[model samples]
Target: MTVKTFKQGVFLPHYKKYSEDQPITTIDLPNEVVIPLHQHIGAPCQALVRAGDRVKTGQKIGESAAFVSAAIHASVDGTVTAVEPRPYFTGTNVESVVIEVDPEQKEPVWPEQDLSSLDKDAIKAAIKEAGIVGMGGAAFPTHVKLSASKPIDAVIINACECEPFLTCDHRLLIEATAALVEGARLIRKVVDAPRVYFGVETNKADGIAALKQAIKDDETMEVVMLDVKYPQGSEKQLIKAVMDREVPPGKLPLDVGAIVQNVSTAIAIYEACRYKKPLYERVLTLSGDAAARPGNIRVRVGTPIGHIIEQCGGFKGASGEEARLNKLVGKIIMGGPMTGWAQSRLDIPIVKGTSGILIFSPAMVAKTEHRACVRCGRCVEHCPMFLYPSHIGMYAENGRYDSAVEWGAMDCFECGICVYVCPSNRPIVKFVRETKRHVAAARAAKAK
Candidate 1:
């Protein structure tokens, strides 16, 4: 079925050709991995192991008491080298467990299990025990997402792959169709949703076709092709497109009687249910002009970006020579260029949220200066949430925290569309984020 299109969305340059056609390959274990204790949205997990302690794959190393938080597992069989603070993607240094791989260690194996006889509760238990989270950037615990307290009319499987140069979801939809479907069934049973819908952007025709074939025998499952646009895969946006339901501000999909899960998260659910394997590895797209062999590789969570690039035939041109000869000016980014974070160091290990590792050569990295807002209304026009970014920016600049919140700054999805279309490059998203932080702090203080 063809899904309905939304009113506002932008079509940015998609540099996906770099690795779209290439199949996913697996990268060998790295010599060392830095496992941050805090990789999810809630409170950071406390360390369960100390330095110099031996660990095996799937062993839980970090756990938290917060109900919203998820657990962290050891990605490789190795010795804990350190249990100290380190640079994490959250823009702050946090305590992490660093493991040095035992090169002679054999590949980890999963314990045999019978899943065909298990029920929905067993599946949820397996997912929670395995520490699985959303792999499509949100990093929310999968078990929590699948377990909804309210009634769910339908379940939406997000396969849009809207961001540029990231084909991890697309490849998974193509290769792991059966697993995704089974995971969707499990989610349906858990949420008690009678119907399931798979939403994919039209750009991924192959994926849509594969999913359709996989669900052909299932009468309750339907595949809907969405208009190709940025942020199409976002929960609220996709819900609107596929189900024509508007999730009110500050409300979750459950409130509107829907639940969304990513394709990779579904695959992880299947593995957890059928094989009892924790989410220690994931498919990551290694691409850009700096890479010699651009493609997707199934990399262990702790595998370093430097090692992944080397396995992908190393960097290309002067970047390659400089990387091989001496450290250079090229920038490395995690996830899509639009919403992804630029890394100052390449030694950071791949976390569960990582979908792609983009290597931009010095020449390709554009360092644009921030300018004032031009009031062109492009940001407003392109915002998926239809909020006034100009007003939010002005309020943020004037330090009017209350006014910014009143102007619906919290509704901003931070999809970077405002930052992308601003002619003056005013970094509107950054200001909105700051305003959100201030507002959140104020609310917290008020609660006290």
Candidate 2:
């Protein structure tokens, strides 16, 4: 199983040194939790429980009629305080279920089952029932991803941990190697893929070594090292790097005889299959100058960000003054700097899709005023998808979404490299997403 190289991916500074070596620890439960109903990509789930209702951990609180959507479960046993529009990381107030925690922690009782004798269909059913989704920022339902109309030829496990200052996946690979490997094998069975490969970045030597050791006897599973680069862990980029196959525009990995799953997703699959437990907790990296204890923490879903920061020993300096003293504490981000959202408030809870909580002091975080695109072509040169971002950005800026789509705007992966390297500091990716939404709406109207 020789590793293959892909084209045109930049090696950005991996500030992973902050917590790469730190093992993941669990955060203490907070006084209350804010569980957003629309955490996944599909239609927002309707709330099932009302205020004053007592809900147990893993109880379904929100659900959707759409097959593409996933159910939302209560992360802890508590009394629902409110079910109304609340501030989320998306910069919008969406409907969320607020719960007041009971001082005595309690576990939700799940139905007993024997997964060892179950077939692939049973396994898929269990995963769907567990409300499992990709924890790697995408938040797409894991069951939907594993379900493909066409046959999958190969399965690629993403362990690259490419995002800087985020070592949750790296720690999972090292500490939960057995579960990760077993999960990959289960995915191979579910998708009926003959071959499975785990792709880890070269920077994570320990993770690669651990995974290699875990999968040594399984010839179908191989641990391959990837070049350390921003967005290298992305589905399209990883597929290109590991299999040399390009996922065409408006097409999926299934079109290329491949299926990709994150390491965290694999572990979740294993849990769903083995213990019949729903996804309620995930590894989250809490790092920055503001964090007195910067490291990876296994956080229970729906736990408030404020509690997480408190558990890590609250911010160093007093209120407004803290930002100045902590070089990396200017603003708080919910995921990796490249793909994460800049959060407005720390009151928002950690959702299933949260991979990291990055706090940047004004100095560590770069802030530049927007300037006109010089057409220097650095964005095009660095785009992993080979789409011309400058043209798309220009079209989007001018409100010509149709022209942007014609120029392959939908193909833009939104990796934020264009935003990162732009000398003019233009919000190229943001404009591209807006244009994409416009195109989607127009197409939907036309279809009707």
Candidate 2 residues lying further than 4 Å off, grouped into runs, are 1-3, 108-113, 319-328, 443-448
lDDT of 1 at 74: 93
User: On residues 57-140, what C-alpha lDDT tens digit does candidate 1 reach at each position?
Assistant: 888999888777788999889999999998876467878899999887767777667767778789888898888898999899
**lDDT for each residue of candidate 2 in 1-448, tens digit (9 for 90 to 100):** 3445567767788888878889888877898989999988888899999999998888888988888888888888899999999888878888999999888887666665665687889988888888888889999998888889798989999998787888899999999999998888889899899999898888888888888888788888887778787788888888888888898878898899999999898998998888888888889898876666789898878887878887887665644345435443677889988888887677888888899988776767778788888999999998888888899999899998888988888888788988888999889888988997898898899999
Local distance difference test scores for all models: 0.85, 0.85
The estimated TM-scores of all candidates read 0.95, 0.95
Clashing pairs in 1: none
Kindly report which residue pairs in candidate 2 clash with one another. Answer: 328-360, 328-361, 329-360, 329-361, 330-360, 330-361
